[model samples]
Target chain A: MKPMLAALVLLASLGVPLLAVAADPLASPGWPIAQNRFLTGKTYVFDDRVQVIVPRDAEDSTAVPGFVRVQGIPDVQQIMVFAELNPIPMIVQFWPHRLEPNIGFRFKVQQATPVRAAALGADGIWYIGGAWVNAAGGGCSAPSIASADADWAERLGEVHSRIWNRGDEGRRLRLTVMHPMDTGLAAGIPKFYLEELVLVDDADKHLGRVEVHASVAENPTLTFDLRTGGSVRIQGADNNGNRMLGEVE
Target chain B: MMPRLNALLGFYALLYGSFAAALDYQLQPREIAAGVYIFEGRQEHFTRHNGGNIVNTGFVITDAGVVVIDTGPSRLYGEQMRKAIATVTDQPPVQVFITHHHPDHFLGNQAFADVPICALPLTQKIIARDADALLDNMYRAAGAWMEGTEAVAPNCRAEAGKLTVGERRLSVLAVAGHSGDEASDLMVYDHRSGTLFAGDIVFHGRAATTPHANIQVWLQVLRDLERQQPQILVPGHGPTATDSRAIRETAAYLEWLDTTLREAAAAGLDMAEALELEIPERFKSLAVIDEEFERSVFHLFPAIDQEVLHGGAGNGTR
Candidate 1:
């Protein structure tokens, strides 16, 4: 008990928050718990350079668009995004090997909550960024429209993609694939969604991969910035092992 | 005693002004052309303050009877509109034409139940399927104003081409894209007055609602209407116009919305970012521009983004 009190005094002297692993910039109540669950004793700091963009008012709660840019932190090994208050809080994880650490995605928000991104740097520290996304609620529990379609099975794994020129910035790749991305919160619906999307160059060299989750909107559309241009292949599979492949220049 | 009576009169006046005036729709019809009168609602979105009277309803008094074009938003509004029309003419409403299935245009079917309430076949079907949900939304939006209002489906089909009722030579034209479906919008051109009732297809001053709009199709319909060159144009919302300015304004707003969404998509701006994009200064004068623009972005940006991503030929939205 003496040692614990001493440690608390030391933390207080250092101005470290007793609750959170690090001070949350967004002041989310669930940030401390999220840090414990995701980081789990890993060192991290709240960084403004890791920008997370979201609308102040989300009209369509089911398809709230989000973008994260981790260009401020170099040598990022992996990045994970989540909504703090969602039933299924985890959204996606990206292992951007050779691609830029910038990604855009549509996510489901059960309520107005903090949406965040944590980038794991090579130095073994997690850098976090987040923003408050206001919504009308009930997005996660509502079953996706694709789940209601009788012929959704036939349309599964279909992909549409395009690559646009960004001049000096980088090439932008936007793509959407047919999947329900069911969160399973709705009654009678089971959890099902794409688990991985692997981006490959024309030479069959792997560039990066995005691990999707049930918190993503149905028929998820994703946008990414790549350092290089040329035709690229997008190969993906759902949790049930259904696979799809598409190409874009 | 005289002072007390005056005080009592003042108290009653204040009470009437506060409660009764607020509750009443107080519809007044303005004669835009010979035999054609239009009740222009306030250019505002539905609110408890305004009820759902943000739409224009008109009637043409002819030798046979009155031809009512598009009933107002709710049953109360419909009842009030009928009373207002009676002040000008003793003839009852013989035929009711619903321009489309939008709640503000057709939800007043109860007032005109005795008459043949007509709409496009598709419009009638859509109203049958969606009116209840639309009415529920109105209740949520306008609160007590929508009390006791029930959605009544159109009982008669309004066909395109010449429609003669009494002495009024009406050309019923079928249009679409405003309601976001094929052959859903119906426009009436009165040959006698040269007045055109352009339903929700045209809006003056107020920003257009695009929940079910196809921008390209809407533009084409507008162009066709411009060619008609009616003497007076009564839009579904805002003031009645003598020229084609309403038609042009609606076209311009739709075009700007279309272009803005397309460019934002091509630029890789997400929907959230697109919502933050600035509205042009010229369109700033339009009523509810900011809210309507936000709604339009939410309703449309996904398809436009998909289109840009697919290089224009992809099937947009399931």
Candidate 2:
């Protein structure tokens, strides 16, 4: 019985340290973990032959990091990513996959978060890669052009989309909207936000939707995947009785 | 495993803390030149506040009227510029010249609609298509900074070409590559003082931010401006640099950027590696150099590489 008691005490002692460690909220997770969630809906898969490149230390633009080679994509159609909370959360997504397996673009990052890149391969698989940015400030929530709200109201229906045809059944489409997509965080003259609901549809079918927080950038430019030669349409409506429409060519 | 978790937690704490402290820095406008003024816009280091100082608008008080060059960021700012001008001059500006089509430079044009606004033909097209977006950006940006100010699209419009205002003869040079329809030029050739307002074409202090910039054409334009050798050169930003030395300094910075980027491209350096390089010593004193310099370099390197790859002459128009 005495030996049993000692064993129980020992077990309790070991368990106490584990509990202490678990209770510490400040513990670090070694590998960079993305706080942003992976979007699951229609999957876009592409070839791994392409490479995604950006600045390593974005803050210190002088330090150029190496290009991250993307693999496992079948046929790259649209390669892009979006900051869920950036002024323009749709960071960048290229359409009609180019022949050169690699492309580069420079973007203003706001804070340290996981940056996810989605690639739609020729095989129609949506593959994603993510990286952590040390960027701190977000540009989407910042002030937009002063006359943005009024102009957005006037030209809200002027929707335009351009599609680039890549040979061999591959295509890219770039869609832009004139919406003030106020994130409900800004304080204006009368102390109100330009609240609105925006939607993207392909042939009257909903592809993706965003519940825009105040962080979406002004004049949101979204580039996404549509099979080459596929016809699409986009529409947007604001809570303030504003609406915009666009047709893909 | 514990160490990795600790590191991750440390990073998160730092990030969240910094984000919470991302307050809007006040944008201060300073009179950088004699007849030239610059509204150095606010730059939010961490948050979603990205709009900084827009175009540098200045006026030369000629005997007949004032020659206003470029407009502010929005129609509201344009109104502010007008009010600012009213304080200095009795008569309103008769002729306005757009230095470029960038929103900050020309978006506020509507306030000056009554005046004969002029710009390159390409600038007109860009403004027509992008005016709404420009105004949206201005409003969103101003709401984040100053109180009660709102962004308004400019109604004033103009076309690109050569024009004369009173005794001041101006030439609109179609300089592309920075933006789709960017027009830089030699405005107001004052025979009296011999000052040439080289808007964005001549960046006196450190390198200018070139996100939508065409490095090759921008460099060539700098060389062309240097060839002209105006006595007093007023840049788009920074203090008015007197003499040809400012022109030389601007040229030297471009040359250095060209050389450095060329070497990096040849070395097969990626964007990240290229950005890591140390900036030259000459630009240390300039404000926001550390923050904006790398972005400038990253933009120029690939742009220069693409220009070389196309086998196009570095000095091609636009």
- In terms of TM-score, the best-performing candidate is 1
Q: Which DockQ value does candidate 1 get?
A: 0.41
lDDT computed for candidate 2:
0.52
Calculate candidate 2's fnat: 0.32
TM-scores, chain A, per candidate: 0.91, 0.49
Q: Which candidate ranks first by DockQ, i.e. highest?
A: 1
Predicted candidate 1 versus true structure: per-residue lDDT over A1-249, tens digit per residue? 899778877897887655343457788889777877887767788888788888776768889888888866888898999998888898999999988898889999988899999999998878888999877677899888988889999989899898878777778888999899988799999989998999999988888999999999998899888877678999999989899999998
Give the residue spans of candidate 1 off by over 4 A: A1-61, A70-80, A95-97, A109-143, A201-206, A229-231, B1-21, B266-273, B276-278, B310-318
Q: For each candidate, what TM-score against the reference?
A: 0.82, 0.52
- lDDT digits (tens) for residues A1-249 of candidate 2: 899667667766876322111111212232112122333334332223444444434542111232334555555565555544344445444443323223333344455444456666676655655455554354334445533555545655455456555455355444445544444434562212223323344445444443333333344443343442456555565556556666666
Model 2 chain A worst lDDT window (10 residues): A19-28
Instruction: Give the C-alpha lDDT of model 1.
Output: 0.86
Query: Which of the CAPRI classes, incorrect, acceptable, medium or high, describes model 1?
Result: acceptable
* Model 1 lDDT tens row, B83-118: 999999999899999998889887778988999999
